[model samples]
Target: MGTADGDGLREFYSAQQPRLVGVVSLLTGSRAEAEDIVQEAFVRLVPRWGKVSRYDAPEAWVRLVAVRLAANRHRDRSRLTGLFHRLPREQAAPDPAEAYGGDLEQALAGLPMPTRQVVVLYYVCDLSVAQVADTLGIAEGTVKSRLARGREALGAALRSDDHA
Candidate 1:
């Protein structure tokens, strides 16, 4: 990357890190993991900044990288869980009940991965449909469908919780 690219990337990093972390945390359900993912994304982005900075939205690229990394990590954990089944699992640290609130958090947690990603990227991260499509490398129609279904699922989940 050129000196100009480095300077631009530094400015972008300062502006976008907190927002990126927020989006990743919403997806991964762990703030610490989210921060790590965003940081790693930034690191990966730096070397490619010359190319990526020319994009219409470089922040979108960073977000896509972080989200993809988080998804890969999730898959790796699932695979490892099967291989390590015989090993005792460590207890996770407790989360504060109010850290992410109640019904909405529960609703989001209940969503399937694709829909959850769509919802978080579209709604929480405030990305446009086209932007989300580009970020996920999916069709715009797919993003719309996921967002629609995700909203339906969230509404149902919340309603069920209310009834209970």
Candidate 2:
């Protein structure tokens, strides 16, 4: 890449990295993994920067890649655990939820990944239902249903926590 391209990427990285990390952290429930995933996504973007930087929302591309990577990691980890019955390693990254506060993060942690993905993209990223559906490659109806379920689950969890 040219110096101009490199400078543009540095600028883009400075602008988008932290937000991407936060969003991915919510998705994977591990700030450390999110950092790695986001970094990988940006690294992937380096080769494609010529075309991607021209896109209206290049960050969307990076976010999509990061989310998919997180999902893949989750799946791979699940399969390994099922096969070996091993405990998960402790992550050194600070809890992403701690930034938002404990209760909501804990409630979000209880959600299935799909529902949590829908919830975070819709609420935290402020994406439209159509946008969220497109991002996750699910139908709009599926996104709506997942959002509904997420809302109900989070509400119940938060209320119970309040009472306790």
Candidate 3:
């Protein structure tokens, strides 16, 4: 990267690292793991920092990278230890109980991966339907369907949890 690009990335990292670490930590359920994920993400992003800076949300790019790294880290742990980072994700989702039991995250975790990805991309990432479709290499219709199904499943899961 050029000197200008390097400076830009440094500035971006300085601005975003705290939020990135907090989100990564919440997602990974480990502060140390969060730090590792953030580092890995910044490393992966360094070479492409210029490209990333052109995006409307450079922080989003970093966040996506960090989350992916955390996922990969969990996958590696599973291979080495026969289990890793498999915490019931929904349960780990920040408490609605503590934050006001809105939608149960545990139920959302039960959805199929594609559906979950679409939902998070749209809802959490605030990406447009087209953006999500492009990111997942699927049609917009597919993105919509997955999102709908995911919402339905999450709703059902939360209801079931309540009844139980």
Candidate 4:
């Protein structure tokens, strides 16, 4: 790419990286893993920057790629778990919520992957249903359904936490 294209890509990365990482972290339930996934998404985007920069919403593309990567990682983990049953597992560190004393974060972490993606994309990323549908390559109705179910699950999780 030319210097101008490189500069544009840099600017885009600077503007979008934090939000993308936040979205991915919520989806993956691991801030460190989210950062890695988002970085890889940007790396993939760099080669297509010339075309991506012209999109009406390039951030949507980045979000889509990150979500897919997280899904793939989950699938790979599942497969590996089945294959390596004898291997001792390394424990993940304490939840990131411990740092902020945020029950909502923990509640969100409990959501199913598809529901969580819809919630994060709609509420956290502030995308519309159509945008999220496009990002996830699902029907708009599917996005709405996930959003409704996700909201109900999150509400129940938070309420239970409060009573506890």
Which prediction has the highest TM-score against the true structure?
A: 2
Candidate 4 local lDDT, 1-164, one digit each (tens): 99999999999999999988988888887899999999999999999999999998888788889999998897786576566655555544343445433366667777777788889989988989998898888999999999999999888877766776
TM-score of each: 0.80, 0.87, 0.63, 0.84
- Candidate 1 per-residue lDDT, tens place, 15-133, comes to 99998898888777778999999999999998889889899888878888998998888778667655665555564433333343346766786676678888999998888999888
Q: Tell me the whole-model lDDT of each prediction, alpha carbons only.
A: 0.82, 0.87, 0.71, 0.84
Rank candidates, lDDT, best first.
2, 4, 1, 3
Which 10 consecutive positions of candidate 2 have the poorest summed lDDT? 87-96
- Clashing residue pairs in all predictions, respectively, total 0, 0, 4, 0
* Candidate 2 vs. true structure, TM-score: 0.87
Using lDDT as the yardstick, the better of models 1 and 4 is 4
| Clash pairs (backbone) in predicted model 2 | none
Candidate 2 vs candidate 3: the TM-score winner is 2
Q: Model 1, 135: alpha-carbon shift in Å?
A: 1.8
Model 4 spans with C-alpha error above 4 angstroms: 81-102
- Candidate 2 lDDT over 41-72, as tens digits, reads 99999999999999999989998998899889
Best by lDDT: 2
- lDDT at residue 69 of model 4 (Cα atoms): 96
Model 3, span 43-105: residue lDDT tens: 989888878899987777787777667667756754754332355656444433243343444
Residue 25 in candidate 2 has what lDDT?
88
Give the poorly placed runs of model 2, Cα more than 4 Å off: 84-102
